[model samples]
Target: MTSQDLLLRILNKLFLGLAAAGIFFGVMGRSRAAERPNIVLILADDLGYGDVSCYGATKVQTPNIDKVAESGLRFLDAHSSSATCTPSRYALLTGEYPWRKKGTGILPGDANLIIKPGSTTLPEMLRKGGYKTGAVGKWHLGLGDGEIDWNTEIKPGPLEIGFDYSFIMPATADRVPCVFVENHRVVDLDAKDPIQVSFKEKVGSDPTGQEHPELLKMRPSHGHDMTIVNGISRIGYMSGGKSARWVDEELAQTLTKQAVGFIEKNKDGPFFLYFATHDIHVPRVPNARFAGKSGMGPRGDVILQFDWTVGEIVKTLRQLKLEDNTILIVTSDNGPVVDDGYQDQAREKLNGHRPAGPLRGGKYSAFEGGTRVPFILSWPGHVKSGVSDALICQIDFLASFAQLTGCRLNQADGPDSLNILPAFVGDSKMGRDYVVEHAFVLALRKGNQKFIEPGKGPKFSKPTATETGIDPDGLFYDLTDDIGETNNLSIQVSEKAKQYQAELEKLRKEGRSRP
Candidate 1:
């Protein structure tokens, strides 16, 4: 047969396979199962800029994530839209800044579903383009509509947002009702003993960190004190659901195994997996083998576990021979915090470890560290590997992927997304014109000049211990000379401040910031 005939035969085989798979597994939530590229967005919870070795972390090695970087693009000036978890995840999935939603600073444990049903999402977009999408692990973004019923199927969640399958912890591991929700129902929930949860009153006589400080391996510094699970105190109250609770130490491997199985089953066609790993997040429970591996305590051990998970995913990709076709984007939700809360010796044994690397501020700071994170795009024979300070943000992913897959996200859909396929593939140097960041206030950037809007109320209520948002009172700084914001150009360069303030307003008014 001629080369053209062979090409046609290959295409016909792939088309037939995808159609059959979609018909067989439509109930699993995969609406489309062809044409789209397999997208695996691996997000690390509360992971710092310096956590991965590729980002200059010296304490522990991340050979797997580093491999992705070595093969593709590693972004040095990339950032999460919000400093905190829930809002950041919201922005990531929705392609819109989190501040727009009312009371969207940082959601509490029992809050209703943040992304309402029928919301347009990255996975939803991919599904339309013919892809099997799944989300496994750490879904801090809330679930259910109005009142959630843990015993029954939760609505307006990952399924409503376009994932074919979902196996997730409802909130942070350090939060209440510690149980895994698979797809719609709570995994292994008992009918005989119902589970009850609340941020208000105690559900039962369950041991709490407040009542039993001696039970804690990692003591809480603030906020994270309520129900006790696996000898660790968390945020909300819970009673019963003993069979459904997950083992803390085994969190990483459990998610990894599930992810691998999903990939193996869907290897024949394009798939989208929003794989959120519960590593180094909270409770800091690293399995026996990885415990104390970094000599920095469980926090460090969890870092190792994160690295192993990355390696396993990469190995699985190689095994399936999908490295070249698959587009792998690895990044963290926010910067690092040595002692956000919890005593994992993160500070005591942090030694010279730089969790935020060279950036100042972390997690909840408007500073460089808060917004900037380690961003990588890997596709083995498709992208050239190199560092770029092109000022990319999580909000940009929606439009970027849409452009890559030959799809369009109408203005209403990806209001914050920008097409930068050339940048992702290392063919273009020109990138985003301006980027808006944070949950509290707006910070606009044009080239090296960055200006932050003063106070528009604020997220944390009280002034955070850290510079959680862009300094209010209209601060303008020339990051080119002073990247740390040490010398306030706000007073000195009032004109530049005015310039970016205008840009900030235009961003909000237009709903999408202009490049």
Candidate 2:
């Protein structure tokens, strides 16, 4: 053979080898992507550790939520990043403590979007990892840039923050703009009657609860007395968008349907559904089917309704044959509150129910009840069926999920999120080295020792009638012995308290907790 012929043959062989290797790696990449499971994170509003039946509530049975615990691992020591809704949600999505940011506090309905655009969020990270992301129901994390024109397309919202599809209540049910926002537009909105919302002053001639108490079906116990919509007063003044306004009674069903639709639409493979429910919140209105069923009035009835919503989602997953490939996580934004704002007989009707279970405080508290919520993780054949005592926090979801999808996170991504995937799937009992709980005051938890930094504030909240968990002198407790946080061990364990105080200051000043 000629020398040119031999050279041509060698070049041809090299090209073929390179092409074969590329095809092999491409197939492997596809296989790994296929193995990634669908994550459905159902976050309940104001649900406490003792609210669900599996978590030891006897007043109201949460059979659907209990089923999740029975199917997989139930975490005994899981907490949200904060005691309030907006802050906890911010932490869960951003993977950074909400305290690290300003203006992350409970936002007004008309407030601007708090989650900055172009930031690394849990859904965004999953989307980059080849997953379809959707958010349904309660979105208290504000919307738009300052004043929002409800008639026009809302920008810098859930869509801009990572969700491919979004069906959200602009704020809370108790807040103004009492309507459902599908994607960027208000659902069922009429262009002629644009929505105008104002937290500052009364916007329209709409009769408020304070002006016309007789018009209300559910009276406000406190400050939820602004605009009257569907015979219920909300926190802010909203006029117009009459057709777009949501009915308190049908909220659970409507949100559940949207969640089910999202799951069905994305049944192809990998998807992330952040289903934040509005049930059991203020204006406690349960559908006719669940009304008077709990025998504990509005609060109890709504809890039952919330359970039904969970059942519907689980049923959809099963019917679609997606249960086996789905990782279902059921948790709450914070602790519970019997009387948030509505005089719905939540406090009066509780015969023997303990909303916070054995925990000390609830809602806007620094105690265990505020941040420690019921956390259940179920993935059929993937996560083993058992109970775990691992100290995991919802803020860790971003990093843990990144690990699951084999996605490499940058140094700036999930700054406070530690990859506790092993503990999440029941593979390990140890989770985080420490977790900081946020409320009126910041509390640090290392192992079983909890330290609350000294602060100046009302010891208790008069509006919600909840303990603020604040003390002029710092408080410390060994949770292994005092789960309710009744005893303060600051004096006894002075050295330990000092160490935790120093660590908390260090973590706060350093900006990121993840090492």
Candidate 3:
């Protein structure tokens, strides 16, 4: 044969080999993508570490949440990044400490979107890894660019951030403009009755709790006394959009339906569902079926309702035959609060039930109970069914999931999120070397030792009747010995306290803590 003919033959063989290899790798890539589990993160609002039956609450029966623990790994030392809803959620999605950003504190119903439009978010990252993302239920993270017209499209919200679809309450249950926002516009809003919300001043001629106390079915205990919607007074005044307003008692069922719909729609492949439940929050109004079930009044009844919500989700997954290929994470945005705003009988009818369990303080406090929440991960055959004391936080989900989905994250993305996938799936006992807990003040936890930075504030919040866990001088505790944080050991362990204080300050100032 001629030299040219031999060269042509060799080139043809090389091209064929390269094409075959490409096809093989392409098939392998598709297989790996299909293998990625559907992630459903159920974040309960104000659900304390001890609220569920599995977490030691005998008063409240949480069979569904317990089922998750029984089926997979339960995390004993799991924490949210912040003690409050808005900030905690921000951290969970952005992978940056909420304290790192300004305006991340609890916001009014009409507050502008805190998360930037083009930022790299958990849902966005998952989308990059070939997953459909949806967010349902309470979105206290705020919506719109600045001022939002309830009758029009609300831009720069969950959709702009990462989620492909979003059905969320613009804020909390007790907040005004109490309507579900699906994607951009207010759900079921009537154009004729345009919605107007004002946090600064009373908007419209709606009967407010302060003005029409006689008309209210539920009175406010403190500051949640603004617009009256569905006979319940709320914070911030909202006018019109009567058709779009949500019923307090039907909230659980409404949100659950949406969540289930999302799951069913995405059952064919990998999906990320951030189901943030508004249950057990303020203005506890459970459905008639769950109303008197707990015997602990509205608060207890709502807890049962939350469990039902969980059960519904699990049942839906099972029905779709997606349970085995799904990663279900049940946790809370923060700890519990007995009386946040509305005069629900949560505090009056305690009935010997401890919301914070053995942990000290709760909700907005700088204590263990404030950030420490019941975290359960269920992935059928993937994650071993056992108790894991791995020191994990919601903030790490972004990095861990990124690692799991084979998505490469830039240095700027998930700045504070450490890839703790090994510990997440129960492969390792140890997770983060340290985790920063943010509340009214910041606290650093390295090993079992926790150090609360010095801050000036009321020791206790009168409205909520919760210990603020604040001090002018820094406080330290070895949680392994004192999980309640009753005994402050800063004076006894001055050097360790100093070291932790320095570390905490460094972490705060350095801007990122992923390293």
What do the candidate models score in CA lDDT, each in turn?
A: 0.78, 0.90, 0.90
Expressed as tens digits, the lDDT of each residue in 1-515 for candidate 2 is: 99999999998787556434443223333233348999999999998898899988998899999898899899999999999999999999999999999999999898889999989999999998899999999998989996799899898899998999999998899999999999999999988888898999999789999999999999998999989999999999999999999988899999999999999999996999999999778889999999999989999999999999989999999999999999999999999988889889888898899989999999999999999999999999867899999999999999888877877688998889998877888767889988899999999998998999988999989887799899988899989989999899899988888888898899989999787
Q: How do the residues 1-515 of candidate 1 rate in per-residue lDDT, one tens digit apiece?
A: 99999999998887667644433222322322233557788999878888888888888788888888888899877878887888888888888888777756666666777786776898888888788989999887888777777888787779998899998888888887788889989888888878888888898788888989998767788867788888888998998898988889888888999898889989986898889998878778888999878887777788889889988989999989998788888888887776766766677887788887777777777767787888999876656788887877887778777766766677588667776656665656656776776745667767777777887554343322555554547767678888776677788888778877877776667766424
Model number with the top lDDT: 2
Per-prediction backbone clash count: 5, 0, 0
Sorting all predicted structures by lDDT, with the top scorer first, yields 2, 3, 1
In model 1, the worst 10-residue window by lDDT is: 24-33
- RMSD to native, candidate 2: 6.9
Relative to the true structure, candidate 3 reaches a TM of: 0.93
Give the residue spans of candidate 1 off by over 4 A: 1-35, 456-464, 469-472
Report the error of model 2 at residue 21, Å. Answer: 32
- Candidate 1: clashing pairs of residues: 364-468, 433-515, 434-515, 454-472, 454-473
Task: Specify the poorest-scoring 10-residue window by lDDT in model 2.
Answer: 23-32
TM-score of 1: 0.90
TM-scores for all candidates: the values are 0.90, 0.93, 0.93
Overall local distance difference test of candidate 3: 0.90
